[model samples]
Target: MRRKKGLSIFQKLFIAFLGVGLITLTISGVVRYRAKKGFIERTIKSQLTDSRERSINYFNRTFTIPIKKDLGFIEQSSSLNNFLTSQRDEALLTKPPAERLFLHFTKMPESIYLSSRFIDSKGREKIITVGKKRVRDYATIDHFPNNVLYRRIYSLFERLKEENVGSILFEGPFRYKNNKHTFVIGISKMEPEIGGFGGAIIFLCDLTGYLNYLSDIKFNQIPIAFVFRPDNHVMLSPEKEASPGPDLYQSQEENINDALFVSSSIKLGSNNNVLLNLALIIPRKIFSSELKNALIDSVLIGVCLIIFVGFVAFFISMRLFAKPIEELSRGTGRIGRGDLDYRIKIETHDEIAQLADEFNRMTESLQKTTVSRDMLIQEVNERKRTEEALKESEEKYRTQFEEALDAIFIADAEKGIIVDCNHAASELVGRAKSELVGKHQQILHPPEEIEGEFSRTYKQHLKEKEGQALEAHIITKNGEIRDVSIKANIFEFKGKKFLQGVFRDFTEQKRSEEEKKKLEAQLQRAQKMEVVGTLAGGVAHDLNNILAGLVSYP
Candidate 1:
């Protein structure tokens, strides 16, 4: 089977350390991003709220509140009232009403007015009007020349009359007599007690220059500033292109997508029909853009940290573990290939050092044991060689004895017992070699002739000076008799006298001699018959001549 491929320990460890570092950095980045996002959101919201509130307060302070205060001062001023009331019976000033009012006030309005119907108790109608330097003709002929301003004041006047309000304050886009558009807050006060029956005073303060000044000053990046009437009519704004105003009665304040919007109605007016709305349209992208930059910066820092951590981890691991482990691996490979002398050289005083010490000791022990075992094996091999030489000699003798043609037996001469026999001897006796041993020598002869033939042969062998040869009839293990030629010798082995006999089987030779005698007898009988036939033939010829003579006499 093929082994599966996989990452090595070094790669796995490196990956584990890198993954941990990267994950930690990524988590930190995420947390930081969330925190920054939240902070930016709150900051943006707070800024928008504060900007909206400040703008509203500034608009009221600069336009609405001052106009109303001026109108109230005019209403409570005893000098202005007495001067205006005396206009019913006498001329309070030789100059026109416009110059006269400007003289009586400490801080004069841009335009001041007495109503057209302000006919004092006398038959003269007193139109006391004063106009700013820019709008000198604002009170000309006791009428507003700008139709837009005329309509706005007329509307507020009608509403104040309907509500029975003494004074009405309103804010709108008013065109000056100079034909220039300006935002203004106006307060029309109807004091029935002062001036006469048709007595009224109108104070108009031009806020267009102030609003334009504010429009040039921006918060961060020029936030959108606009002024709308209560009916959402665009009175003042910085947009070059005019805005498509909302419904005339639209009163809801809402944010548009990513822009934050807030509107504040001027509260200084008793005129419900008119409202001064100051709106700040702050784009939300400012906050998001800042947040995005912060997030990018945080991520960059996190990446740098992760990279630094990875490098540190790599350096530490290489120094502390990798080099030592690599040395151990190489040592293991060398040892596995039978290099018992190889040793791991770890320099650190840690567990690896201990392991190297143990390994070196084991290698030393193995080397020593290997040398000792080699010496012992050499000694054992010498002993084995000697044993093998003896075995070879024994095997040669056994092969000759088993291969002999004649049956050979060794019998103890003193005991008259068979001691050992070859395979041929066992065959001649019709018994196995194992069965022939330890048996009396009489077993080789017939049962009737055993004591006589075997005893004589043994006695002859014992008495003769040399070994003896004899013909003998032996009985096999099955009781069949066979004639064998036997030669016997007396030998002394290990200080004991033993009889050795070599026997040749003669059963086939005796059969052949009997067959030859019968064939010779048959040949003699055939020769005698041949001789008698020759004599009979000659005598018969003579007898035939005599018998011929006797037959002629008949």
Candidate 2:
């Protein structure tokens, strides 16, 4: 018979180090890639959501609230009410409402409203505009011969008289001159003190102009802003279309050039009325570019680290393990080649050094056992000496097994019965040797639990020479449950298949790991909230300035 050749210690150590380095590199790469992907996804979604929220806030602050305040001012205007109460007069429309009241339409830039007009309860009309634009004759107009505008105006007037409405922001009519849309922000009580059917004031502003002003204000990265009616008609879109879809009332999501699209719906009235579908198109690529670059850099760094660690590991393994193991190998080779006097010399204190000492002792013992064969040629004496040596080896094996620090248990593989256990096992389970020796292995585990795990682990140990370790809950004699990690293997003992296992307590380590994960999650949420707070502060500052201007401009 010939012995098979095996890998040298140097080769084995190099392979082990290389495998570890490659596996580490692979796992790190995967984790980094996934984390980067998740971060980018989160950042993109967050930016889109933030952009939508800011858009709504800005729209309400810049356009909606100011419009409401302007209408409120018109409702409280005593001079305008006096002007309308007396009769429709061109001279009264030309002047300011009062010394304290400034006409909003006259103060606004000519580009803002295009034209601001007033219509009374008697169906009389007068223009109170800033510029000398030709006033279209509303009486001679044939666009609404069926009186659709008149009916809508009357309905709003009724709502105002009944106090059902204070002010209204509504889409009124289309101007025939340029066929442009108009938004009428009207107030019912032009003269509230008079207390008798006081007429309303309608401000005709070009919808396109207001939406253009809104879209011009870029919140971040030049967002595209547009509005769509419930009928899917484009009311105002200074930029390109935000999304290509049939439904225009609801919010939308789209992707363009790796950019995310988000939309919000801001209705102008209370009763499912005019829906201004505001869509803001922002580039997510711009937001995630830094994270993408960071991920690439991380991958490169991981590769470099893997290479550097492999080289360092190889150098250390050569010095700590390979050299001593190589010397032991050479001594064994010499002994096999008839040089039994050769002894391995190692100066380290690790496992490899211990192996060298054990090998040397083995050679010395072999020499002592066979050296006297030439001096005394008695078969019975040699047989007796061999038996004595075998008994001594068995005693040493028993002592090592019984005195091991970790709890060890031997059970019958087929029946799951505890056949043998050491002192450590008895102390760990809090049971006497006599009480546990003949009992089933289930006595050491939680009742109604861990049964499936016990069966699976036992079957796995029976099939594998090198088994795996797993966490399990064990029950002690006092019914206290303990978390433990068990490593089990199968072996044949006295013609019976026995499962032997070592138990290690691992409750504290698992708890620490869970706590660490929870802390990381909390840190992420805190960072997100901090960003939201900063955005809110900036928006609030702008809102304060806007309100100051509205109040101080008059």
Candidate 3:
């Protein structure tokens, strides 16, 4: 199986750093979001409570005193006794007159008043006049007296009379005789001694202005405020009427259970009509909206920042690590493809630099090894060629030796025994090469005589350290004796001493020599006869010449 390439130090380190950074970013972002959310929630809650308290204080300060002074004037007036007894001055005894008298008596800057009369002893009532006589009285009970408002007010008065208290609590609707619209009302009865009136002073209010004021006020801009009221009426906020003018006779019940209710029977005014005080409250929804906005903004900012930072970090980390790693990867590829000379060149002094150095060293060693291996291979090939030439030469020499006519024998120098003999040698010895191989030289001939000669020859060779030639006789395979001429040489080959001999089969040659010697003797005898004849002839010729010379001189 093919092995996978290993990763460089840079690659491994970059991966590790990236993983750690991502984990850290994730953990930090979550922590920041949670911390910011919690802080915003806490801040909103604190501010909302503070704002509610300040609003309530401002509301009480703005309306409470004037309302109390008006009620006080009414309690001190004895004019109500004449008006009730005559009943003819109803138009003069109502609000504008009453309001003007009270305003003058109390020395207040602003005052509002309304008057209602029960013309019949039944439940029907009419609003006589509202503040400044600017509002006209309703014609019938249908115009002013309503079930929810009139019934509740009448019950409150009855209760007040029975208990002999200055005021009674009531919750009901009140109609504006002029605008023909109605609002919820709350009335507090003024004492006869304080106002000289046996009637209730009505407070006209609604949840709209209270809730709106709570929403508008900022806590830090003013003092904090809150309200305590009945809970049931908080959920019963009435729809606002379209009419623009204030309803003097309007009555709004202050439920004791509402968060806006300040007191069940607390004196709102300095006089008899001051039983209910309206305390402002900051709406919980406003605080919740602020908290939500803060939380959302913090989360959005955190997410955007974290993403931006992470992206930058990732790119920076890659630039630091990935570029070097890619360089190393390319270097590795070159090396793997048998480019042992390839090297990584990096200037850093970190672990990657160390790795590059190690790689360079390894490649250097590999180059050296390659050179050495090539040299070794060439040496082996040369040796193999030389061995082949030597083998061929040996085969040629062996073939010539076997086919030669001369008898040749190789003997062991130390043992004086035949080591190897050619075919002719075996024939001359009258034995097979196998039989002659281990035999002593003396065994080839007559034992006593040849042994003595062989001993002399061997001793002579040992002494002179040279070749020796001698005539010898050998017995053939047919039991025939053959004469031979032997030449022996002592040689050393391959660290072993050996004796080599070549013998000519001189049996026929010796006979021819004998015949030639006999022919020479016969030729000598014939040549002597011819020489005697020639000397006789020369003596006869000299005698004949002397006789001839004597005859011619006489």
Q: Highest lDDT: give the candidate number.
A: 2
lDDT of 1 by residue, 325-384 (tens): 888889988988999978889999988778878888888988799788998999999999
Ranking by TM-score: 2, 1, 3
Residue-level lDDT of model 2, residues 1-554, one tens digit each, is 99898986666877987887788776886788788877776665676677668767765665576666676776666666565555446545534443224344545464334445555555455434534343446531223245444555455555655544355645554443367665555666544455654555555555655566556745454646666665667765545444545453364664555455677777564343554676655555555677668888988887888788778877877677767767878887887787778888888888877887887788787888876675466776788899999999999978998899888999988888898888888888899989998887878887655444354455566677347897678888998788888899888978988889998877678888899999999999999999999999999999999999999995
Clash count list over all predictions:
1, 0, 35
lDDT of each: 0.65, 0.66, 0.55
Candidate 2 RMSD to the real structure: 31.3
For model 1, give the 10-residue run with minimal summed lDDT.
114-123
Scored against the true structure, residue 231 in model 3 reaches a CA lDDT of 28
Residue 151 in candidate 3, Cα distance off native in Å: 2.7
Which sections of candidate 3 miss by over 4 Å?
A: 1-27, 62-65, 78-99, 102-128, 134-148, 173-199, 203-554
At residue 313, give the lDDT of candidate 2: 73
Task: Return whichever of 1 and 3 wins on lDDT.
Answer: 1
